[model samples]
Target: MGVATQLVVALAIMCAVLLAVAFFLLPSRSNKRKGLIQIVVLGDLGRSPRMQYHALSIAKYGGHVDMIGYLESDPLPELKAHPNVNIIALPNSPRVLQTGSKLVFIVTAPLKVMLQAWSLWSVLAYKTEASEWMLIQNPPSIPTLLLAIIVCYFRKTKLVIDWHNFGYSILALKLGRNHPLVRFSKVYEQLLGKFATAHFAVTDAMGKVLRSDFAISSPVLSLHDRPAPLFVPLLPSERIAFLTQHELTAAEANEIIDGNTKLIVSSTSWTPDEDFSVLLKALCEYSTSAITDSPQLPELLVIITGKGPLKQHYINEIEALDAKQELEMVTIKTAWLSFEHYASLLGVADLGVSLHTSSSGVDLPMKVVDMFGAGIPVVGYSNFKAWSELVQENVNGKGFTDAEEMAGVLKSLFDPANNQLDVLREGALKESKRRWDSEWKPIAGRLFELTT
Candidate 1:
């Protein structure tokens, strides 16, 4: 054989050998088993704490998830995708049925949701060759729940109800306890308690309330609130940069250090019950007052970053306060931010504020967790026991009952001589880790087990 011909043959042989080795190392079609469990998540897929937490857990863990939910009218940031994840967007438009009979819902709503769910479930059921699991992340509409229950019963599938909040209690608070909706929710919850294979609550307090109040037979699991983990380590320089990115000038950054300016940040969907207007009035009052004996008061700046139904109302209140001239109350309509982006914003904030009135009970704001992760001190109304416990245990934040106390706490936090800022920062970081381990991980593990 000619030398060139022999060399060509050798090269070809080497190429074939490498290809064969690569093929053997690669995952085979048979090795890729269809996930053992199929989870159907029913909720509003818009940026909600419960939905985000469950979706992330499903992505990390192994499962084929069919997310059937309502998408926000506004565009949302793309969520991290997983191989097993399938998003089935629910109809955003209102459902209309032509019927004079009140009993129409008895036939219509369930039929619609079931038909929609069945379309996806049928495909997964045949392909996976496994009994599917249905997880209702939030309280489904009564008709929807009824349909799900009927489907589960027929399919012999296990049902898991994740009680994100005490909906029945909320209903009672909003509408009198004697209201039909409140009573109906109670019955609905009891029915779910009896039928569901498992019940997951966001906090131990929530779980205990379920077991005691609802007489639920299913084993109650505490799936505590776990904010998404911080992927990027935040350095001091990076924190300053984050502030600048949001439009804080170099002089303002120096003012933060020199204690010549104070920035109070409250980043949440502005709701009437949250009482942003009250906070605005307090800050306005504080800012206009002269500091005679005390050291120069920091130039108060309130940065509000979210929008909701109450956005216009808050805008009107801020304008009324004339916070634009004196307080620099800037409202950023950033309804859609990736978890990381939101955390970075919170991290640079000097103080985080969230207040709930007496009417708002047992509410734990997700922004509070973001603040904790950012090592930012939180000052808010302490109406809820859970909030009080977290703030007290962490020693990273302070809580109060009303606007006066809240204002007092903010004054103390921004005080230069206090030297307690470092202590709070250290405490917040420690508590963040403790919360991740004790609360977040176990809940995530439980969700993993359910999905797998």
Candidate 2:
């Protein structure tokens, strides 16, 4: 209790404080280590393009990246070829979760989370070397966020959440907002969200919401989606070869090759957020308009891409229409395409359609970005505020609310006489120049630079 003893205790406390500050501020300090970044997604690696782009950017700058996700589909060819990138495939979901009743899902949800938690914990805590940072996709955030928070804490890693959309908003689509599970998810997301070292929002609106509504104290960056280098417009000479060699059957390809049929493309997850009914009903309306109302409109070959739960339901509807053979002005085709093929299709297609009216009003869809990057004009569903950020009406793209409106947009854009299609394609080409690497580089360099 002497004065000398009190001074010694104070010095010990000061030393402890300095060590704690050094531990946390390492990313901002000049002595930053190499970015051993871990990028995670609960969904398929191929389906999640934004996170893949993140991994690609990290690796492009000489950082070592560990991308963890489901390998349901193939990712970009360059991602596989990158020597600095190591992709760790997560274990598959329980069979009951994939093919199950609503009641069964309610019963199995906890078990699914537990299994996922165990897998992630083992991989993050034991299997992988200590990392400097982690960038994880949010949406199926239940187990991802929880495991990330714990892993980052123990590993002394910085946790970053790329806010594409809220997990609760997606779940609320099936379970109402008032549902207890949905309510719990929102609370959990917000609580854990504040723990992130930083945040990357797909739109400026999303960043604002994170700071004001979610009360997130960390720095939030508006890092909008941009297409990777693979997505580019195919040359006029390449069209015939692409159609013949790739996804489209020869017969389907020949229809457009031999006729004045316009090829229109749309990519969807085939989920409730994207009501394929909107596109389907619009096609029927478009057929009527293209025939009787707008004869100037070209005949259409519509291709909808990507796999989802509702895909088969929409396919059945199309099959029924085909069996009836009542609609002659437009033909419908669907394919679950690889990124290479998907990019090529976008490049060659005359127009792109997006049915994504976001579950959270703040998100911008990456499919629209891909379309623009491929120099294809888009007709996006515009119920959400963020749609304006990417789809500028009459500029790079147009926006529609209902089937009738979408049909009208399609008819006008596809009409050969108007020259509107060329105008919009030119605008999209301008947007295409604003590619992902340039947008991602400055941020990636600063964040992942060795000895920051």
Candidate 3:
């Protein structure tokens, strides 16, 4: 009785164990359904060219993106009916709370380091089953990022840190190299890299800096800014007419150009860092030379758009250069506009300018892409490697080192015999399509992978 009963009991137990294993391993019908990816964009919602590009990319790829940040006075209209996007507004108090929390880190630096490590361990314990979390670069609150890293660890979610600019570098440049905040930022960046699953650098140069400086082993992907695709067809004639009409009708434009204007446009949020004053100086110099030499010289019309904290400074600089008489400054207050309207304005401009100094680094500005899409020639400074590569010499545009060169480039672009305008227009359209087909489509594919 003992041997037979024992054998039967052992067989039954073995079968039960096998059944349990199968139940756990076998795929369920629910697992076959489409996957959902939820992305939290921690940044401002309005007047961000980069954010707009990312939102459009995610929307096109079927991923759900939620943006949490401070709201603007005039909210973006495009964000309203975006199918796969959600904009969450953070209260003012949270920002103050987050800022106050950082004082603990500053005052008790060594103790805070130990506390942060302990907090990371505790957070990682709770996040074993969540999806990946990506923290976009240039976070306004450093404390918030520290907390996000802890949450990412606990959730067992992959962490992606997108680096737009090296905050430490910016700080070192503005302040001294030995500034405490700059040094601390570098340390925090290294720590982030050590913990992050992946990294995205806005430029190849920035990626190089991260690898060389921080010794970060994580896979760094270059997520350079690519312009939004233009859905509207290219209408060259209408664009020309728009510019011609604006110059003729607008008293400011007329005063600047004195009818029969040679249109040169630039749209930027005139910041001290942008060096728009150089552009104004160049424009004024060109106007003065033209008036003295040729009585019938084409009226040089410069249209400047965008408004920022430095708007008054830029206006004063323009007035100082006597460019106010030859330039029309159009300040943009609203955060949103239809793509059609933006494209139409861009298309009308004969030439577009994007000039920035060494402090700006190799930025892939959204306006550059817009110029390409609108088939407008762009002239700008060439300190940026990315800009140099894209804006080929005598192809799309010319990148200058100084204001004199900038004016010379502009003068050349206006020459009727040069016929460079036609060539540039064709090249820009080709480049725009190339960007969409290559960079943007791949990004869309990546978003699809995350979502489904």
Instruction: Judge candidate 1 against the unseen true structure and give its global Cα lDDT, from 0 to 1.
Output: 0.57
**Runs in model 2 with CA error above 4 Å?**
1-33, 247-249, 252-259, 450-452
Q: Which candidate is the best by TM-score?
A: 2
- Model 1, residue 311: distance off in Å is 1.3
lDDT of 2 by residue, 69-127 (tens): 88998988899999999999989877766642555555566656666766676676656
Q: Across residues 1-452, which tens digit of lDDT does each residue of candidate 1 receive?
A: 65533543464445446434543453322222334333444444655655655655555565566655655632123443555556655544345632323345323433444444444333333333334566776544343454455546655667777766655665454456775546766787666566877778766677777787778877888766645566223688887786666553344666654556665667765544577766765675555442434444566656676656577776776666563564442222223355556667677667777765533254467677767777777777777756764576327877777666665666666666786666777777665664443454465456546332
Clashing pairs in 1: none
Give the distance in Å from residue 234's predicted Cα in candidate 2 to where it truly belongs.
1.5
Every model's TM-score: 0.75, 0.90, 0.73
Q: Cα deviation in Å at residue 10, candidate 1?
A: 84
Report, for all candidates in order, the number of backbone clashes: 0, 1, 6
Q: Residue-wise lDDT of candidate 3 within 26-127, one digit each (tens)? A: 322221113333333334455565665665666666655555454553334565578766665543333222222333423333333333333332322332
Report clash pairs, candidate 2: 32-451
Error of 1 at 118 (Å): 11
